[model samples]
Structures are given as C-alpha cells and as structure tokens.
Target chain A: MTANWAAVLGSCAIAYAIKLSGHLVPHRVLQRPLVRASAALFPVALLSALMAMQTLTTKGAIEVDARIPAMAAAALALRARWPFIAVVAVAAVVAAGVRALGWMS
Target chain B: MTTKPRSVIIRDAISIGIAVGAYAISFGALGTTSGLTVLQTQLLSLLLFSGASQFAVVSIVGAGGNPASAWASSALLGMRNGLYGLRLAPLLGASGWRKPFAAHLTIDESTAMALANDDPADSSHRGARTGFWATGLSVFVFWNTATLLGAVAGSHISDPRVFGLDAAIPAGFAALVAPRLTTSLTRGLALVCAVVAVAVTPSVRPGVPVLIAALIALTTAMKFGEPIPPTTEDVSS
Candidate 1:
C-alpha cells in the first residue's frame, strides 16, 4: 500500500485502540472517588479547552481574530437566555461580520 | 437538575451536529487539496471520524511532511479520545456488540452532550445515552454527507469559514457547558483551565494543551474539590 494509505490505516487503528481502551476500564476503577470526581469535572475542562483552541488559537499559535468576538457574542446570547441554535447563529454572524470587514483574515 | 426532555437532548445534539457537520465541508475541501483522492478523504471521515486528528494528518501531508510524522501528530491528537473514553466508559456502560460502536462514536461533542444532559440525581444513564447516541448519529450522518459534498465540489464551494461556521463548534460547546458553571468551584476551575490551555497552546503540540488542561482540572478537583454529595445538590443555583 502507499504511504498515504498506510497513514490512514495506522491512524484508524490507533484512534480506535485509544477509544476502546477507555471502555475497557473496570467498573470498580471508574467508581473510585478521585476517578468519579475527575470524570465529573472532565467535561468542563475539555469543553473550555476546546473553546480556547477553537477561538483563541490558529494552527498551534495564539491569534486574535474574528472568532474572539464571535465567542463573546455567543456568551452574550447564552447570557440573554437565547436558545442553543440562536447562540451558535449569533456567533457565526458576528464572526462573518468581523471577517467581511477585512479586519481579521 | 431534572432530566432534560428527549426533545431537548435531540435539539442539542442536532444543533451540535449541524455545526460540526458544517465544519466537515471545509475538511473535505482541504482533504482533496492535500492530494488525497476524494475516496480516500471520505474513508478518513467514515473510519477515522475524529475531526482534529484527521485535519492534522491532512494538513501535515499537504505540507510535504512524511507519513511517520503525520501518523505521530495525528496519534498524539487522538489521545484525548482515550481520556474521553475513560470518562464515558462507565457512563455509557455498553456491552457485547454495542461496545465497539460506542467506542467509535466517542468524541468531544458526544461526550459533552451526554454529560451535560446527565441527571446528577440519578445514575440511570438514560438521558446520557440519548445524548450520546443522538449526537453521535446526527454528527456522523451530517459530517459524512457534508464531507462528500465538499470533496466532490472542491474549490467550487465557498469557504465555510467565510460564513463564520468555524465559530459554531466553540459556541455550541460553550452553550452546552454554560448551565453547569453555576458554582464558584466549577467556574473558577473552568476559567483557570481555559487560561492554562491558551497559555500552553503555542508551546505544545496541537492536542497537548487540552490534555494538559484536563490533567490540571482532574488533579485540582482531586486535591481540593469538595467530595461529591451523596444526594444531588442544587448546583444549578
């Protein structure tokens, strides 16, 4: 097989393995206090990290761009009790508006 | 918090699906430009199924990086899914033939949706399961469909970024987690982790910052976070 194909298969194998490993953890281990607490907080951290990565960084570098205002707008929408779709739509609109102004590429 | 209605979970899942799926269009366009065949790109979307890792491989290959490097970077980025698995395994509790399918569908959005809708008062896993399956299937269908569209159309399609679709993922994520950030502990930990993630991103590899942030949150919670109350506390307030 070609290198590209090799990479593709290798990636699939590795990704699947990693995912399966988690499900294999014993139920007893999962019930530990530390583990349970960490699991509870994991989503908060991961989501926050994800938001930072998506909004604040570009290809491993920190860059201020349209996504910043877009995130701010999203926060505002959520604060105002806008529905989930509306919050996402507001972010997109703010981002599109920012980019259309030729301010952030 | 009460168990969110099934419709609410579906709504959250579909919104997230649409946002993430919209991003897939760009992924498809990028995949072909990176010299992979349309078929190859679709295979990645279908099988590999993780967004950041797929993007890592495509971009690295597009930059003339060797296969070893591409695999390494993508593998590193995918490790978070394993961490996600650790959390989701107990929550999902899939057994028999369903195990592999559940593992395959494990990703950021599904995990977040599952946990977000989880009823702290109960461990029935009912709502969490709906969130997981609905979000997983919704994103899979939309993402793959959009990938095909972007791949076949190629440069003829306008950039998804131009419409600011890129913001949708982060926005959707923020909305999912917002309701749970009521307590000072959760809020403070989230803020600190976000800062640490941003602080470390430029210095680390693509997915490492998030890992680091998760580690920090986990350790901090273990060290100083209050013990879980036996009964559900009204944390929403």
Candidate 2:
C-alpha cells in the first residue's frame, strides 16, 4: 500500500485543530453550565457509540455473531468485578470458543 | 513538593504499562499491515501513541486514501486528548518538561484512572504526580515496545481480527467507561451516548460519530443538572 503523505498530514492537522479549538475557548466559557454538562456527558456518548460499532458490526454488515458471546462474557466478568484484563480475556475466550464449537459460525 | 508514595506511583505505572503494551501490539500490527515501514510504525506509536488516531491513519493509508485524508481522520480522533489535557492541567499544574510529557500521555485511560481518585482534600500534587508519571512512563515504554513487536511479527500473522483483536478498541473504551459509573446520570448518559453513536456511525466518519455522542451527553447532562463527581481516588491497588 502506498503511503499518502498529504493525507497523513491533513489528518494530523485536523486532529490538532479540534484540540486547539477546544483550548481556544476562553476559560470562563468552559465554566458555563452548558459546556460543563457536555463535558460530563461526552464520555458516555463516545464510549456507547464506540461499543455499539464494535459489537454490532460484522464486516461492514449488521449481524451479530461471536460478539454476542463476548458481550455475555464481559457481563459475567463485570458482575464478578474482575479486572479489565480478566474481562477482556473472558470475552475473547468465550467468543473464540463458541466459534470453535460451530455455535457462532 | 510532597511526593506520592513510590509504591502507589509504581502500581499505577504498571497498570498503564500493561494496557498500553497490549494496545500497542495492535497499532504496530495495523501499521505494518497497512504498509507502514517498521520505522514509520514505531515513530507513529512513539509520537502519536493514541490508538484510535493511529488506527485511523493506518486504515486510511491502507485503503489508499490520500495522506491528507489519513492525517485529517487521525487528527480528528486525537482531538479528545486535548480536552483531557485541559482538565488535567489544573490538577497536575505541571511545568517545564513535565508539561509536554503529561500532555502526550493524556489519553482516556490515564485520565479516568487519575481522576477516578477524587480527593480534593488530600494532596493534589501527589495525585497529579502519581497519575502523570504512571501513565506517561507506561504509555511511552509499553506502546513503543509493543509496536516494535507488532511490526516485526505483523506480516507473519494470518488474521489478527480472528481472535477478536478488533474488539480491543471497544474493550478499551469499555474499560475506560465501565469504571466511571458512579451515578445514575452518568450511567444513563453513557448508555444514550453509546446508542446514539452506534446509530450515527454508519452515516458519518468513525470518530465524528463519537464526538457527536459526546455532545449529546454533554447537553443532556446540562439539562438535567447532573453532578459530575471528581475522579475516584480510592480504588484498591
């Protein structure tokens, strides 16, 4: 694959722009109730959208497969209050195991 | 300046190390798979170290997109860290060389972990030092090492996705988000954001949807008067 230097530079610039814009906003504005609320809630929206994208999509199509088992494993791990590593391991193993068993082909 | 106990700092560092290391492997693998030279991959990790941004860059490059597009995509994703840095600035009050290092390491996981321990009454400086050093060192070392490994072994692997490797992004986010569920408002906001993000993802760019979700959650929080708790400071080490 050919590396596109222009694209790389552009992407970097855009990323920095987003960050700089946030910083450019005056400190007082940041303390405004609207801004504070958005900051507080932003993580939730970001993570949720992210989680859905990963768990719901299959090769660009909407179809649930091994991810279901993985999510299940994750839930169990959460219930057990396991460490993050343990939770991921459990989910991956369960998902892979189920696939191996032809349960999620 | 009162220094935090070395043990606490070290433990936090180790956790950061493990998390960054594992994620770096994916970054390296993606870099090489997407045609990045080993040097390029390592540089990306060393300099950028932000997974989503790195992923966006490589994925765009892999798809034969223009370098400008690739950079734009990665930059969009990297914007969040700036917000993280702003939030942490007051807490860290870092100056000199520490400022740059802390800024670089200001990712989701580190921010959450650092802020999770909310004890405004205790030593704020100690908390900042522990969080900054732990996260900065961990991401610096582990991310670089893991990326190198991935670059070396990247070509040999048949399918990293088969083992649910792609899930790392979501899993990582989950790790960050799950720990922050201290109140009903936060939980509900998280749920709404996730759902809305997923719904909007296909219609927009990968990172943009998440940003929108963030905005939605932010607005909702404002409307509801939800109390934003300080970071959790008391998780057992």
DockQ of each: 0.45, 0.40
- lDDT tens digits by residue: candidate 1, B136-186: 999999999998987786545357578786676578668756865766777
> Model 1, which residues run further than 4 Å from truth?
A1-15, A18-25, A59-61, A80-86, A102-105, B1-45, B48-99, B102-161, B179-182, B202-206, B225-237
Tens-place lDDT per residue, model 2, B77-98, is 4655666666777777677876
Q: For this target, which candidate reaches the highest lDDT against the unseen true structure?
A: 1
* DockQ, structure candidate 2: 0.40
Report model 1's TM-score to 2 decimal places: 0.59
lDDT of each: 0.73, 0.62
Q: In model 1 chain A, where is the ten-residue run with the lowest total lDDT?
A: A27-36
The sequence of per-residue lDDT tens digits that candidate 1 reaches over residues A5-102 is 87777777887887787788665654566755665566567667667766777677788889989999999998898866688779889999999999
Q: Positional deviation of A54 in candidate 2, in angstroms?
A: 1.6
Residue A7 displacement in candidate 2 (angstroms): 6.9
The C-alpha RMSD of each candidate to the native structure, in angstroms, is: 6.9, 5.0
